[model samples]
Target: MDASPLRDPTIGTGAAAGGPAPGRVVIDARALSLTFDTADGVVHALSDVDLTVREGEFVSFIGPSGCGKTTLLRVIADLERATGGSITVDGVAPAEARTQRLYGYVFQAPALLPWRNVLANVTLPLEIFGMDKASRLEHARRNLDLVNLAGFEKKFPWQLSGGMQQRASIARALSFDPKLLLMDEPFGALDEIVRDKLNEQLLKLWAETAKTVVFVTHSIPEAVFLSTKIVVMSPRPGRIIDVIDCDLPADRTLEIRETAQFLAIAHRVREGLRAGHSYDD
Candidate 1:
């Protein structure tokens, strides 16, 4: 599905606002495929999947359950190996990019240690990287503030609400200052009101940091609201069904979802999902 005609021409490419210039590819994948050797049989998780993520773009992958969205993200993070074709991150192999700390990944869960307080949890990665105590504390505090968790340093994971815990997780991911952020449905478990609030916060965070983001989600509105580009995928042997450019206003609010233009883009995304057999029996 071609969505270029729907793109707003007035929107700038975001280079002037400290965002990465257009045409700089952060992720390049060609004919990428992955298969699992199961005891029952070989399972194809992805096939001939080609994708490109430009610098500073908030790209979201939306698909049905079991469609390899997270698998593809893991491949880019070097957490999973592709069985065929080639892929690169920051113009280098995924492994090399990971070794260089080119990206930070936030999983579905907060994944914070229960025994540690928010400050200690956020500083854990820096601690592992051999950063000094003073420097680690500084980084942790700064990121916590960035995520609006400045006063919760002493609170343990169990002490905070679910949304706050996820914010702490995000702060921990940002502690190392990676240029790219990979998120796998980080707000999937939150209540609708909390999810909406976090979605808004996440967009602001993306803008302030000007970081390239690759997100995985199953929600149409969430994907449309948060993405600069939305990748629609097919089932099991996941393939790119459509890549829709979402040129909505950079500083959009949740209220924008009610507008005609927003609804139009969302309609296209729904059509793409339908075309991909996302609702097949």
Candidate 2:
């Protein structure tokens, strides 16, 4: 399906004079650390890390491989436990926030079931929540439409192209209407053309849904383009190297990426990555 805006424009300035506006802190971390114990000895994945994501913000985590970009995301999702320090989602601990279903996660791959059609796949979570069939179907249909997958509801995963499958994954994530959306390199595997298209669509989705998004990406351009705030991390024992607040206008087109402002931000991200490498050396 072609990329298109799913709903009326709903983009709003994320925060005002003070920090995060009142009651808008969606994800907060302080001196967060994680370490792994193996027979080979101890490995520190994260150290003294801190981050805060406000409501209606699009935040991207960028770093080199094994930099703990994904690990940090998993920490927020409560999929992985931190060995030390603290982190919270919506004012509660990660585990507690998870129980409250405060967020939805989209992995690197679509990870959709082969047997379930698009609609069924999107509705799976609602079904798990024991929502009535009528309500679940309605919710699924709405989300599918939001992803521009309305006509493909009856198609199976294998029947959809990689980009479409990822869109379905997004639809699935939105079905529950979670306040936060955490995407881990959702378009990393697609061809450049497809990836660019999905990126455009994702921005539109973010604007319309007005949900806080935490995305993980290795692409500097992608991170610079999509993030309202970009968090750069260092290698092993991942530590936040920089947190850049993007100053671009909310209503942006792909063409904006060619402008000096976009290039400047991208350069800063590049510098942060280079600095990380220097620290490692």
* lDDT, candidate 2, at 3: 11
Quote model 2's TM-score. 0.91
Model 1 agreement with the true structure over 114-176: per-residue lDDT tens digits:
999999999999998899999999999999999999999999999999999999999999999
Per-residue C-alpha lDDT of model 2 across residues 1-281, encoded as one tens digit per residue? 01122211233244333333433567899999999898989888899999988777789999998899999999999999999998989889999989989899999999999999999999999988999999999999888888899999999999999999999999999999998899999999999998988898999888888778899999999998888899999876789999998878777788989999999999999999998867544
**Which pairs, if any, clash in model 1?**
none
Question: Cα lDDT of all candidates, in order?
Answer: 0.89, 0.87
lDDT of model 2 at position 39: 92
Q: What lDDT score is found at residue 188 in candidate 1?
A: 94
Q: Each candidate's root-mean-square deviation in Å?
A: 4.7, 4.7
In model 2, which range of ten residues has the least summed lDDT? 1-10
The regions of model 2 sitting more than 4 angstroms off are: 1-23, 279-281
